[model samples]
Target: MSYSEAREMFADWGVDTEAALDKLAGIAISVHCWQGDDVRGFETRAGASGGGIQATGNHPGRARTPDELRADLEFAYGMIPGRHRLNLHAFYLDTDETPDRDEIELGHFTPWIDWATAQGIGLDFNPTFFAHPKADDNLTLSHPDQGIRDFWIEHGRRCREIADGMAAAQGGEVVNNIWVPDGSKDNPVDRMGARRRLEASLDAILSPDYPRERVLDAVESKLFGIGVEAMTVGSHEFYLGYAIRKGAALCLDMGHFHPTENVADKLSAVALSVPDILLHVSRPMRWDSDHVILLDDSIRAMAQEVIFAELTDRVRIGLDFFDATISRTAAWVIGVRNMQKALLEALLSPQAQLKQAEAALDFTTRMILTEEIKGLPHAAVWDEFCARQDRPTGLALQSRLEGYQASVASRG
Candidate 1:
């Protein structure tokens, strides 16, 4: 199946394959830096992985330093088509002087800014609210102790500043996402108390108003984690209301919800209230395992909803998974490309025809057209996309990945 044939087929259904490719090329997925290093950021005072965050595999060639991680990211980006952004956590700061999470300054992240600028890419940020001694009790911003809550609040404030600096350096806005791991292993008597403290802490952190064009704040929620199974402080309902009231973006992590829950369904509901949305595209193996994403129904539905509802500008997509079992760079390339593929598939959908059928109350035509769309030559169009970007597809892509894996096997 050639691209021209595929294009003609799509055209017969009132879909423009060329326009779809152009849109796919413009959509940038914020590739997470943590994936390259198994979420082990370069903080000198880094503690043991805790707060429900754990990267399980001992894949050799794990990036041990900032430079190594950046090198791995560069290689992954080469295989992935289109310009994208880098999602950096606060702990990933690269500097000689040691800085605590609350004390981190933009100087510590200068190297990353410089790298992104040179690569002609954008930047995104996250405040690391886990794996610290203060978070040992599975609480940070919502901790019972006022002093402890204040400390985490300051960390959040500093992260926003760093995000502002990054946006200034890149000459664009940076999505500053906040996800706190504040929950009890068992049911707590003071859920309301903890939530109140969290609300106060967040208010304090967001007090200093940064320019919206430079720093786009987003709050993420989780259903449960390793130890916080009983109750997560930042649950979906909590953040949904908070985002609506605070005028911030609500982050919907694919792995943060129940396995049976369709994250795609929430897009339209939340879009009605929140100013914007930030998606953490991930795969959960019965839980928030942070496995690399595949081009499965979950991803396809997400892409289709964004396109079908005309919410492209309101939604910001980013990848969030860390699987150290495979070649780290390969994981990145595979996950990002899958996301691109899903978006392209959605873009090629005969949306006008589908909507017309639905509006006319013709369920049979809608169902038939949708079923037939699955048989379209999407793979041919995908191949053309990679070819246009000078990237390999099919067996060639696999061969390149194997060669890179072999090259990195020698890394200590």
Candidate 2:
């Protein structure tokens, strides 16, 4: 069906396609930098990735250097509609001087700030808490040793400062998300002690007050990892309470929760307590596998909740998946576009009509309309969006992907 005809059909349901498209254009999905290089940051002292993070394929065109990653990102951004931000890690710092995690400074990341400024995009940040000798035991921030905890605390502090620097350079606020790999594979005798140390370490790390407008602190939690199956110190309940007490943004990673749990339902519950939320939009096959996002029911439900709860302003959407089996750049484009598609579908929903029916106890109308809206010509509106954004749609998008992959086939 043509976009005009689809528009008329949506209008019959009291939905405005134009407004939906406009809103979709404004939402920026923070594309992760790790996907370009399969999470291998350019740290001189970089260690093997552990803590349940594994990017399993050896795609031919894995970005080898900072320049290559940035170039790949530029190419991916071209195909993706709307101006989005880049979520950077502290370990991705590009500089001549080799610096450890704790010693990293703003100068090391100045190139990224310049690049983001040039691209007319904003920056978000994360402290790399895994893949180091200190984290080899799967303990950081919550380590029993005071000195060890201090080391990770310093790293977290520096990351927040770097985030502040990024915000100052880009003239916007930067979300600095902290996720630790502190858990035990076997059942621990003293979970309380570890959690106490974690809380204290976090307090120390957040001691230095960065401007709220420039730096927003967020804490992420996990259920389990490959090694840490017995217990995860930074579980959902721990971070939820901490965020409420600290007035920090709570990060809800789609892949971090249990398989049976619905992240969409947690939005409203957490929204009531936390000041802001940072979402790590990822797809989990059976575990926290970090698969590339698809336009699936989970994504649609999450997007719908964001719209239904009127939590757009309070939520920051960011992608967090690294699938090395495919073209990395293609992975970025596909995942981001699917996120946009989900949001667009949510925007095009006849929410007012459905809500009105539910309020009036018209269960029959609500259920019928909800199911019927699924058959709407969403693809036609999506195609129109891509056309207006100068992005290829349908077969053209696939052709572009093939061409880009072939162009980068010689990467060694």
Give the candidate number with the greatest lDDT.
Answer: 2
User: lDDT per model, in order?
Assistant: 0.91, 0.92
lDDT per residue (tens digit) for residues 4-85 in model 2: 9999999999999999999888888899999999887887544655666789898789888999999999989999988999
Candidate 1 error regions (>4 Å): 46-49
Q: TM-score each candidate.
A: 0.98, 0.98
lDDT minimum window of 10 residues, candidate 2: 43-52
For model 1, the local distance difference test gives: 0.91
| Model 1: per-residue Cα lDDT at residue 388 | 95
Question: Cα lDDT of model 2 overall?
Answer: 0.92
Query: 1-412 in candidate 1: lDDT tens per residue?
Result: 9999989998998889999999999899999999888777886544544677889898878898999888888888899999999999998989998877788899999999999899988999999998788888888998888888888988999999999999898889999999998888988998998889889899998889999999999999999888888999889999999999999999999999999999999999999998899999999987788899999999999999998988899899999999888999999999999999999999999898899999999999999999999999999999999999899998999999889888888875
The Cα error of candidate 2 at residue 381, in Å, is 1.1
Quote the lDDT for 168 in model 1: 90
